[model samples]
Every structure is written in structure tokens, then in C-alpha cells.
Target chain A: SQQGEEDPQALSIQEGENATMNCSYKTSINNLQWYRQNSGRGLVHLILIRSNEREKHSGRLRVTLDTSKKSSSLLITASRAADTASYFCATDHDYKLSFGAGTTVTVRA
Target chain B: GAGVSQSPSNKVTEKGKDVELRCDPISGHTALYWYRQSLGQGLEFLIYFQGNSAPDKSGLPSDRFSAERTGGSVSTLTIQRTQQEDSAVYLCASSLEASSYNEQFFGPGTRLTVL
Candidate 1:
């Protein structure tokens, strides 16, 4: 079973706008990682936030984790057409990762 | 450095036929993983291997699904008596180590179609 569930199954926004998606998990995790999938094929690792870490940033991406709530959110600032893809949140535990269904984001050009 | 690689970018077979999918992890990567993604669905963990230790097969859905990793570098996932529901993208990933702190590097998945 999937551990995480992403809110807002889909999102559309103009280029240069900010896009935000939320993920909620059912169990504890050692770390939470976000990945991006293009064309429903390969998924690329985006960023990871350990349970002890509250937030992390990488380029245009920002991630936050709240262990108490078992939730995480990913924010993409200044969205670009290239950034349009399905974003997924994965919870890592015991050397395995459970992924959420995903949020499909469309950056209108 | 090269990234993880998977072969037979796409495969189509009739039901009941056996199929094999291959994955080649990046050099020196000690941990390899296999996942399956159905249409519009999240990835489902299929199997995991770390170094020479026994693989964690806890996530495999059925007896027909089996995988093996050799020399801690290359891996193969095989499906016996394929079913229509078995059609999905098979993804392979490898991490530098087994630690949860390491991010996995993924391969361009192989799309499997069971007719």
C-alpha cells in the first residue's frame, strides 16, 4: 500500500508563478524525498528532508516536513515549462520507499 | 559518471508468457531497487538488494514475480505466467549505499505490456 497521499491531484499555473503541493503520510519515516516524473516514465530525485530537518531548499524547489503531523509540502517557485511533470513524495523507511499517487503540475507557457 | 540503465525499453508479450527485465546500476553503487508503476499510479516497491546480503523481497506482489542481482551491480526482474494486470512500467534505481540518507538514481524504465 502507498504510504503517502498527495493533495490536489493536479495543478496548473502560469510560467513564473509558484506552485505548491502537499503530501501526507500514514507512518513514521526516516526521511522524505520528492521525485519528479516526466511522461510517466523515469523519475528524477528532487530533494530530501530528514525527519529531524524541518525544511530544505534546492534551486527553485523548497521542501518542508512536519513529523508530528506526518505531512510534507513541496513548493516550486518561478515555475518553468520544463518543470511541468508529475511530482511525487516518497517516504523512506527500513530501506524501502513508499510513494504517493503524485501531483501533476502543468506550467502554462 | 554513467547513470542506471535498463534494457528493452519496451516489451509486449501474451498472457502466460514469461518475461525478463534487466537493470544495470551505476558503478560502485551497492544498493539496487526495483519498482513498478501502473498508469497514473505511484511506484510500488518490488524488491531491494544491498551488496551480497539477501534481498528484501517483502514487497513482491506474488510468487510469479522474482528478481536477482548479480555481482552487486546488475539486476533482473522476471515475471512468470504474466497476467494482463502485470502490464506496467518497470523502474530500476540504485543508491550509493543502503542508507536511507542516500537518494536513488533511476533508469529510464522499461514499459511492459502483457496482452
Candidate 2:
């Protein structure tokens, strides 16, 4: 399977704290993407970082990619209760994405 | 603009029965994909369609799984003679094209329960 793996299967942080998730994948990829799922519902695209990109930022979300190690990390700064969800990292190759087992985040109100 | 849409948000069927899940892509998008997610698991690609070209079914797990896209817009996934293991959330996504750089827009998935 081309599917990747995400570490720290679960996380709990204060509403104002930060949450970070790491992902590692096998095989070459053109890009990697982060998605957020609320209560097992549909996934919302969070960010996409290409293989050549080392870091990218959007709002409170920061993503870093290290193609040399075939790994990436997502940082949600100053997370809120609304940020509680499952985060998944997918490797994009051949126009398809192999998703990783997500990291479930729980934010304390 | 409206995002992707799916029908029959939840379904429960017998192991020997069949089920169909539908997906509607964003307007003018040329790429559609089908995926399945077992409880507490990650997404598994089932098939992919680019415009009117033949779909890539390399990810389909068994012969009981099949899908079809009509007019490059809407798609349907059919599971025949389903087994208890077939229970999962079927998700659909659409992108502007088949490029790896494109971000896909997902639809609320259809939850299938095989009893």
C-alpha cells in the first residue's frame, strides 16, 4: 500500500495551546496535503505543500515538508476548541493521494 | 459556488445485498475520485476518473467493487454482494484536473453499514 503513517495518534491541548502532527510516507511524491475532519464527517482541505517547498503557512496553520526524509509536519498555532478534529496527511503521486492514519486532536475548553 | 455533494448520507444493508453511493463534483472540474474509510482508519483510494477517459481502478480491493462516471460530472460507486467488512464511509472528491498539485474538494461521505 502507498498509504503513509502519522504519529502521535492522539493529542490533547488547552484551547490556546499549539498542536503538531507528524507524517512519514514511502515512495516518491509530487506534493503532500493536510486535511481536517470534524466528527468523521467530510474532510476539509487545510494545506498543500509541494515536494520542493520546505515550509508554508496559512492563517494559524503551518506546514513543513522534508522530501529528503519523506516526512512532513503540521502545526496548528494557538488552537481553539473549534480546532478539535482528526488531521490527516496524504501523499500525492500519480494524481492520487495515499492517506495516513490521522492524528485525533482534542482541545480543552 | 457549491461544493461537491453526495446522496444517501447513511445506509444499512444486509451482507448479501448491494448498495450504490453517488457523488456530484464541482462545476467544470475534470477529475473525480472515490475513496473508502473504515472506522478509525485512513482513506483508501478506490477509483479515479479524468474527464471522459477510462477510470483507474487500481485501488479497488475486489471484483465486487465498481464505479461509473457519467458525462464527466457525476459518479457512482456500487458494491455488490457486500460483506460485513464492506461497511465504511464512502467519500468523493473533485479537483480542477488530474495534476498532483491540485487541491481536491470533498463531499460529505455516505456511511455504509453492512449488517
- Highest lDDT against the true fold, candidate: 1
Model 2, B12-87: lDDT tens digits are 9999998999999999999999998896555889899998889999999999999999888889999999999999
All models, DockQ values?
Answer: 0.82, 0.74
Off by over 4 Å in 2: none
Q: What is the CAPRI rating of model 2's predicted complex? A: medium
Give the interface RMSD of each candidate: 1.2, 1.5
Best model per DockQ: 1
Interface RMSD of 1: 1.2
Residues A1-109 of candidate 2: C-alpha lDDT, one tens digit per residue: 5468998999999999999999999899989999999989899999999988999999999999998899999999999999999999999989888999899999999
C-alpha lDDT of residue B56 in model 1 = 96
Report the lDDT tens digits of candidate 1 across residue range B22-94.
9999999999999999975558999999999999999999999999997778899999999999999999999
- Candidate 1 chain B weakest lDDT stretch, 10 residues: B38-47
Sum up the clashes in candidate 1. 0
Fnat values, candidates in order = 0.87, 0.77
